[model samples]
Target: MTLDARSLIKAYFAEGTLPGLPDGHFIGGRIVANSDGDRLESYDPGNGQAFARFGAGKGEDVSRAVEAAQQGLAAWRDTPPATRCQVLNRAAALIRERSDYFAVVEAVDSGKTLAEARGDARSCIRLFEYYAGIADKLEGRSIPLGSGLTSWTEREPVGITAQIIPWNYPSSTFVRGVAPALAAGCAVVAKPAETTPFTALLLAQWLHEAGVPAGAVNVVTGLGSDAGAPLVRHPSIAHVTFTGSVATGVGVMQAVAPNVTQLTLELGGKSPLVALADCDVDKAVEGALWAIFSNAGQICSAGSRLVVERSIHAEMMEKLVARTRTLKLGHGLKDPDVGAINSRQHLDRIARHVEAARGRGCSILTGGSATHDPASNSGWFFEPTIIDNLAPSDPAIQQEIFGPVLSVQVVDGEEEALAMANATEFALVAGIYTGDIGKALRLARSIDAGQVTINDYWAGGIEVPFGGNRKSGFGREKGIEGIDAYVRTKAITIRH
Candidate 1:
């Protein structure tokens, strides 16, 4: 069913705030009805038209949020693991109940295709469910110490955490960042990117209905400087989890210094997808296109660099260009496929990268531009771009463009392919496309990335941990390892 603008807005906010949720409360549990009233408009990326407006808050807002989180932390921590699991299970149910509204809000707010937005909204439900199952399963081992002393270890919440999520994958990233922290008994003050706060706020409303303690999960919407920084720098915050650009991550790291708070940063990537000669060229091209253009390549682990063996580079490039040209770019709210960029700034950034690559002798195969049609350019939209023949060392190749532009290069052999893949300093993820299982496994192990995929370019499910090895930043975001990221191991000993 096609959702018009009026119907979409009605579906999200409905007649008013989510039923039974406090009129003006932070997701983390603060009541701010009289607190300085301010709001920001969320726009439709397809046409730059405003769809909805969310409240804007500052230090006063931060204090209210932290207080609410602080108030609820002890009870939540003391709650039975089984109880927490039940709460999360119900939260997942509530989210699923409202998935359509979330999909609509997410699609318009972030310019993601409606189908993609629905997938993300569903993924959010899965994340909550997955973490719910693991909530009661967080266990620590008993370490043997030879003596009359008895010793064991317990994994405890590290107190309140301030999670700052990015614009891309708003539903997935926000929940993925928040759910595990909640499962581990930590209250969260999440600051989602200003441009895409609707889904996060909607999730917050769902959590409230699911019986999460009033302040267990708080979301404050505003600029990163005011809202994001305050949350990170707050003295009461025990941990800071962030997902965004390397530049911003570095800044956050610097700001949180002296406090020595625990940090889990999932930063930028210029991930490479290496296609071996023996792999199917058509399939490899398809995989590469999806890897780089999904969410318009705003993903941190986008395989933006395509490294093909020289023996098949030319043929693969032909297939890649042809496949890319077939991708439809238009209003995600109405399209069956690829949609607009998240914002004007993102579209400009993609354009600049393509221009730079062209100036440096790279050839445009297809889709290297943007359009201003109301249906397509109302939001941040860039065409799926492909720049071939760029040197592996070229600035456009090494640096992250964070757009729909794909840079292709040729390598002489398997060794050369591995070498070229490692050329980029940012090593978040790498994929190997090869018919030989041994070669694929070998390269997967040897690649300097936090996660590597063999024969496929997609990052797998929640059971698999995802992060980076080098400057792509530290800390795992999924799987059992993610639980470890949210807690501190405490060893207690008693002499008998």
Candidate 2:
């Protein structure tokens, strides 16, 4: 028997350590190498230790990814909708089966608590299931063009999509955004936030095991300048879907402009939660606190702006301040209530907002400093803070802080509250807590947002079409409308 020396050594020692698996890189498709292929280390915000190193791409790699995506398009589009649904459902099931593993990886890498990470994992699975159920229901409507030869509309998949996710909710965003694109039969190249790529990498592995075709989905873990810019500017990429800061979204839009690519941007917001005088002050306070501090106020649609009627403003502010004082901030793993800040940069941003608000004469009702516990000193963390007596034009009311900070503004009446809420540049989401049905309906209809809740505060779910007007960016994700973002409509006419 003639055996190569390399093969013999591999058989002997590979099991132990010799040929270690690659740390992290592209998945589900062929990776086209570029000269600028660099490595970036993802650090745990809690411990500041490098947990994983992922590949960073350059300009040329984008072209290669686009080509690979084009190649996969035919196979993915030709796949029966039912089969695609089955594959997606299988991935969802696998997510549930290995929920704990993903939760641990997410907590260590992203600085979320195990419980919150588990919830994020479960939400990802539910997102996949939701989109999978709608795979067969995506249809183009029949256009009733009065002067047309009998017109029937067909929805056709766009060729290739470039989707960029943010670090705050990387897992949920990836699953929510990608599942709909796949269900619509479009191939995708995903650019997860560089800070949290481990969970996304693991998700790609599960997708392969779930029987998703190779090259149908790809992940490039890298910096925006290298990987993201290339993906956006690639000529073959038909669409761009992004969820991040407004500044980044603007850059993406500029890059894709040359190609005339369809774009969907779910960007930043300073959403408002209004409390009418007729509403219960305690209930409003509880709802407002959860809205502002859930997920550390990292959500785009979170009601960070509290616009309350002046009649009950003092009482409501007292209750809100009391609640804020009760919040505990520490290492996510060690605490059951609040988690560590997402990163050091985020902590700095929150501090700046507090300083600026104080400079502008806003009162710090309660909670303004980071936790000083020796055990959690290593983690980037901050307390849930409340600031009252701010004008509508205050920076805290206009800009998205993306942290656990809420600013309270007093309004004279219903009309003034509505005016203040509509003053922000973003129209992603707003909430109204009112007892009067007429007032609730009026506010809901008048608010300049994609979705409004009369008494609730949840957005970006499976059933609702979530997007924004004005600068909040266009295109809906989730629901039947989400499928429309990945496909184009064509009218077909036949005459005998």
lDDT of each: 0.82, 0.78
Score residue 334 of candidate 1 by CA lDDT: 63
In candidate 1, stretches whose alpha carbon ends up further than 4 angstroms from where it belongs are: 1-34, 373-377
Q: Relative to the unseen true structure, what is the C-alpha lDDT of residue 466 in candidate 2, on a scale of 0 to 100?
A: 87
Question: How much does candidate 2 score in TM-score?
Answer: 0.91
Per-residue lDDT for 1-496 in model 1, tens only? 2444447655544442222222343645544542577777767777777765667777788888898899778778888999989999998888777676667667777888888888897888888999999899888788788889789989899999998989998879988878899899998888889888767777887787787888888888788987888889999999999999888999989988979988999998999999999998888988998999888888899989999888898888777787887877777656645878888888887888888777767788887777654443345667788888778678878889988888888888899898899998898999989999988888988889999998778858877898996789999988878877788989998888
Q: Residue-wise lDDT of candidate 2 within 350-376, one digit each (tens)?
A: 888888888878888887765532464
Give the distance in Å from residue 71's predicted Cα in candidate 1 to where it truly belongs.
0.4
TM-score of each: 0.94, 0.91
